[model samples]
Target: MSDVVTCLWGRAGWDRAAQGLLGAGRRLADELGGKLRTIVLGPADEALVTAAQAVADSVVIAEDETLAEYNPESYLAALTAACQKFAPRAVLLGNDAYGQELAPRLAHRLGGSAAGDAVELSVADGQLRVTRGVYGGKATAVIALMKSPGVIWVRARAMAPADAGAAGEVERVRLGIAADPRVKAIARHVEAKEGVRLEDAQLIVSGGRGLGGPEPFQKLQALATAMGAQMAASRAACDAGWVPASWQVGQTGKKVAPQLYLAIAISGASQHVMGIADSKVICAINRDPDAPIFKHCAFGLVEDYEKVVGPLAEKLSRHS
Candidate 1:
């Protein structure tokens, strides 16, 4: 059996996360000395097929009207059948909601081992091991999978996407699965966001509770605009309704790995730091010298955000 990596296409077909997923799969498959077979559940658009082919040995499409929206039961069934057919030595999925729900159950169904939120994978002495954040991202734990067909949900931005190459073979499958009537989806509401999605942004400007109120976010937004970056928030700001829930970034919120992450008045809780651990460079603007965020950032300024943001925004605006 080869290594099987499965992902559902984004609403517009292939999205940014697709490349990283396939990249991880490619690495694991190469380490295992097996072919990488990626299972994508969406329309087999030419662009998707071409991109996946560049990284995977084979690309399998499972497209049907029943598979349009994400229903846990239907997706589980589809993945179960696909894994069984492929008889994969390992299975990889994203660490988002879908993977968190399905990974353990899929392992149970397949009689394999499962791990979640993995950031690293390797093979040593013919055994597969994974490294993941522990204790709310303050520590790391390495786990070894002793069973065949290890099911793993990898964190986003954990690996650089594999470079494109010659196209590979493509296949199509049908599961004839249907959504359960008991769990019909009424409607879905997506939060409207301007500029780049936080996950894809190369730069980010984030705020925390110390900002005092929602109005401060406007200043951060202005800084973000000047810097050509996305805006995000800590959980405290979101829970207080100072920022939209979608803007929250923490262990329980969105994980981001921008080239530069600027924290404004953030205290740097471990949960919050965990979300930005992958960031290339972290800078903080907090008045408190003992703020935990200072420990994690490469650059730190002990000044009130109000004193720094306005001037910084003005300077950046001039350059822009």
Candidate 2:
């Protein structure tokens, strides 16, 4: 039985489970009186390894050309080998795209079980107890996994990443080098996109169909850029061509848990609400009091957003 919790680290920034993984890492470090080893998977490895050294007790470096763009096969293989060699009691995975894909495969390889989107996890009755949200984020349920070694994917924004000031000097080691003849990163390219990516943004300012047309969506965009925030569009706004699909936020688009989510002229549909449910503050603006958005919004302003927006924007500018 292992008493350590190991984390899967990323190079191009950790996915959704960044916070919870760090939280789990710190907790396990304190509980076990041992260190949390953060293992990073990368094609270009050094950059992120340097970043993780600030928090982790030790860093495991896995490198491969096939892993340049996150090919699943090599990643799972390397992680499984590391887990077996280290024999950590628990493994924490980031619940983002890569984490969701890698954790299950690693568990399968290690002959253990895996759980996804876990919000709360604890050791109870000699078993791992996990909490996960379900039914459209309306309710959460507890689950117990009776496995010797626990494997889990903690969802994005579930727990904040640990804040350890200043990074330690990173130690570079080539432990598990992958040999995959399947894929190669010949070139890397970024498609031209808008100002901020919603998933990584600290603040998000969004608009919806209630804004009327494409003409008014600019106001939200301007406000977002001015405040150094990401501009998000509801599914309805994208469907109407008011904004691009990449900026759309909802169950179908993207799940963002920014610190602050401001819904402008938005009625707050369930599909839209579910995406940003992890936001610390939800301020929704809509003229319709019964828009259903009010039910979930922490701050609801019942006024024509056109009138409320200019004053709000003006007031915000004053502080900046």
Candidate 3:
């Protein structure tokens, strides 16, 4: 069998993460002189098939009623079947919850090596190399995989999306794996937060421990609304009960790469900075001039957030 790069497309529709995987897979396939194959495990949809075809050499749809929702057991079985059938040189998956759980397990099942949270990937001297953040984003490390069929989980927003190419043929594959009886997904619970999703937002306004309490988040929220941005918080703020855990953006929280990130009252700890390392620009407003965040930010205002935030929101509102 020839070298092949296989990517798993999740049910998030052909979202940015999927696009990144496809782009990275395409480059790897080109370097290996192989083909790029994408597999979708849910019920088939024309839109998904078309989008997958735009970037992949071939699309495989594993259609099964049990896969209508994510069931770890059935998903694993189907993935195993795909690996056996395709005999790929490498397998790429998004570095999200599902991919984080499946990459290692699938690698173990296939007797292959796995890499997680890869921000960059390339092939050199016939070996697969993956680059990822280390030491909580204070540094980065590159790992070389010697084994064939390397499984990799790619970080979101790290790779650019692949341009739409010629549509490829679609193939349907069915795996006989049945859903486990012990585990059932009766319903999904989504957060009721309004405004743009933090990960998807182009601009973000974040607060930290300087806010002191939850009451100040409303001010940040108002600023965010005025600027058409999303509101987020540092881990300290979330831990201090000033905001919901979902709003936290740090090593222990969501990784973001927005075009602009405005951090207020944040100390800019390595853990917090790691999450926004990929942001195009960073601006900090803190009373402490020595705040670590100031060193990493593109712009800094050493002033109390309370004195500036309300007036800044008003100004933005007027401009809007």
Candidate 4:
């Protein structure tokens, strides 16, 4: 059985698959000793086919008028149909909102067990061994599967994309209408995709309750823009609603592995530190010299955040 993983690329159909998911998909593909397959659904989705060719070996299309808009049931129907026909060794999905909800249901229908939020996978003694992070990344529990085929949902942005320039290939799969059930999305509202998302940024600059209020966040955003960095907030600032929940950086928020992390006025709570432990370098700015963040930081500034943010922003502007 060849390895088969699906790329749920954004709906324009031609745009490149989300870079974050591509990494884990490629890793699993190589480990499984087979080429990866990608799937996208849309109307006139020629572009979706074109872009997926770069990462996956084959492009499967589920083109239906009703399927143009994403309804979980419709997608599950078409996807399950495809997998049953081919019967891949294993199926992989991202640990995203959609993936988390769909993978378990798909596994039940396929008559297999699914390991959620799997961060590690390897070929040990011929069987596919999966490692799932348990207790919030404190320990990794290994899972062995004896069954023929199963499903897995790996965490978001956990793996890096592999280079397979010449291996790209494309194919098409046509599907008939799938059943539509009780729940229906009557309307779809799309939020504007703005400023670097937490997943894609190379660097993150964060502020905490020390920033005073929502007014200072404008300056932080300007600094983030000038320095080509993402703006993040500690749980405190996020609870205050100075920034969106999506921008929160902590154990409760998105974990980031940026090249650099700048902490201004942050107290360095362990909850906050957990998310940023993967950063290449950390620099904390706080008035107190004994702040806990300094212990983990590579650099430290014992000064008021309001004072340093402006100067640092200026210096970054000049260098940029």
Cα-based lDDT for every prediction: 0.85, 0.73, 0.84, 0.73
Which ten-residue region of model 4 has the weakest summed lDDT?
Answer: 12-21
lDDT of 1 by residue, 168-283 (tens): 79887777877667667789997776877888789999999999999999999999999999999999999999998999898889889899999999999999998898889999
Off by over 4 Å in 1: 10-12
Using lDDT as the measure, the top candidate is: 1
Better of 1 and 3 by TM-score: 1
Error of 3 at 232 (Å): 1.3
Candidate 3: worst-modelled 10 consecutive residues by lDDT: 1-10
Any runs in candidate 3 off by more than 4 Å, and if so which? Answer: 1-6
- Give lDDT tens digits, candidate 3, residues 1-320: 44555556546776667777788888888888888888887765677778889889999888777787888888888888889878998999887778888889888888888998888889888788999988767689999987767999888567888888858779886777787787788888889968767877799999998888999999998999999999899988898887888998976788788999999999999999988988999999999999999888999999999899999999999999
Clash pairs of candidate 1?
A: none
Q: What is the lDDT of residue 123 in candidate 4?
A: 68
Model 3 TM: 0.93
Candidate 2's residue-wise lDDT over 1-320, tens digit each? 54455555555564445555776666755565556777766643454565566667776666555444566677777777778877776788876677777778777777777887787777666667778877767888888876646688876465767776535444445555556767655787775866556787789999998899998877776677667788888998899988888888876777788888999877777788778788888888888888887877789889898887776767777788
The TM-scores, one per candidate, come to 0.95, 0.83, 0.93, 0.81
Q: In angstroms, how far off is 49's CA in candidate 4?
A: 2.5
lDDT of 4 by residue, 1-320 (tens): 85766647355333221444555566666877787777665554555455556777776666667677767888788768877886776777665566777888888888877777666666677677778755544566999766646687765565665564635665555678665976698887775687666755778888889998889988887888888888898999989988777778876677777888999889998788767776779999999999999987999999988887888788889989
Backbone clash total for model 4 is 4
lDDT of 2 at 5: 51
